[model samples]
Target: MKRRQTPSNGTMFLLLGFSDLSLAAQTSLFVFFLLSYLFAVIGNGLIMLVVTFSPRLNSPMYFFLTVLSFTEILSISSTAPKALQGFLKAGRTISLIGCATQFSVFIAAVNCESSILTVMAYDRYMAICQPLRYTSVMTVSVCWKLTMIAWIFAFGNAVIGFSVLFNLPFCESILIAHFFCDVLPVMSLACGNTFFLEVFQLIMSVTLIMSTFTLIICSYVRILTSIFLLPSAESRHKAFSTCGSHLVSVIIFFGSAMFVHFHLGNPLSPYNDRMVALSYCVIIPTINPLIYSLKNNEMKEAIWKLTLKIVALHM
Candidate 1:
């Protein structure tokens, strides 16, 4: 009789180190993530609603803002709920396909956001710096085309990234170290050597991130120079106020992103990895709508009107 080969221990599912988290800590994490998810959804949803209903927000800037809100909502939804469930259940195991799908969605949303932000900066430049030609330059057709390009670019990137992972044979290890199914964390679980894939992904990610960030920075610099040359104090103040919130949000999103993608080396500690992931994935999305709406007067008024209408309806 031929003997059957038994699966190795590494091939079997294990709890990994997350099982060591204290019960209180797990409970706290679950609650924290749950609240974060709710805020992310509600905040972005409100922004979408305001942009959709307000006639004053029918411009290109608000259109991009609506798309951004949608992207942020999708990005947070990709991982936060799963992480919360894992915290509550004390089980962190995810299937191979599930992890890959999560990563694909996340990468798509992130890449789309980067490109959309760059387009938004250009839109601001036209509106503030070249006001006379703004309407002509940024027509409805142009805006639609640009948005389509951003989505196509993001979808292509996601497809290519997932294709790379699809070819890899998973070893017995299915435990991902991070709270979410990030590329680095998921790649770490592959049984076979993945040095080439890791390097490729790192290069692609850095290139995309750096290029978009550079465009945003250059756009803002030019915008500032233009503002400074403005003869009217009121004009300068308006431009500064308009750009301030966007600048802060961009810094928070891109800065945290660059730090995690560029600074963190392989073989990351679980705690540090989870913390960094939470900052970008959970905290940033939850705070972005608040930052933008609070800073912009138009958005604030729109929200106020929306609230009044809802209250009046219930009366």
Candidate 2:
């Protein structure tokens, strides 16, 4: 609200998303991405079904995982469909209102993932550190509350971010650099002074992401310390195994998010940024179930049996 520029209310914005690619490349990418999206959907869908039915998975950890799968699905869906549409058509275009809405949903979904991962870290911390009190501490009611807070907080953050973006007067050239309506690229189009909003976004991204990652690192550090303190080597190994899947997820998500957010300006190229965004937003969620299947024996056993049951039913 500081500087003066005209607001392009309801003006259409064109996204320069993959339009530079050759016809053959675009067709090839479309086929590949279609398969990947289907796999991610089916995988996450299976997790939701199995967890819902398996009473043994009624524990806090699995409950949190169900919520995560749901979030990952929502997150991937937020941008993938629209991008696919972009590939199919001449160019990706959206009304200002549509851009704002997409921005809000994408931002909220990503934040939800960050919140859920942090909550999962706490679950692991309690399970390993205070095994006796883990149940009492993370009750059914408490899990619901924690999850609600994550969702609510995420949307709220997105709302605030949207407000900042919407308040700014935009440039005449309404072409967005990225595939979808990402905040930074959209913000970069603003004319006049946008220093405040830009700084606000950077600060928010740094603070929230760094703090959550710090908490996770600290949690794992304590868990590892406790594991090593165990009398038996087998017991220590068992403890480490329990957290392996979540730790790997943390590393991938946090590392990707950090690189994308902080490497925004001079250090990053737009081309590399697109690839990174594709990885975390599309590829990571798609492979999330794969990570669980390979790393966590419990989820592997359950998903494998569930897959067999479904196949047999079809037979």
Whose lDDT is greatest here?
A: 2
Best by TM-score: 2
- Per-prediction tally of clashes: 1, 0
User: Candidate 1 on 1-315: residue-level lDDT in tens?
Assistant: 222222332332332424458888877777888999999999999999999998988999999898899999999998887776676445566665666677889999999989988999999898888999999999989999999999999989999998787555565555666677777765665665678887887789889999999999999989999999999999899999878877887898899878887854555577877778888889989998988888799999999998999999999
TM-score: model 1 vs. ground truth: 0.92
lDDT of 2 by residue, 223-290 (tens): 88888889998898888887887888888998898888787544356666677788887888898888
Q: What is the C-alpha local distance difference test score of candidate 2?
A: 0.84
Give the Cα lDDT of each candidate: 0.82, 0.84
Q: lDDT at 26 for candidate 1? A: 76
Stretch of 10 with least lDDT, candidate 1: 1-10
Which pairs clash in the backbone of model 2?
Answer: none
TM-score of each: 0.92, 0.93
Clashing pairs in 1: 11-172
Off by over 4 Å in 1: 1-18, 264-267
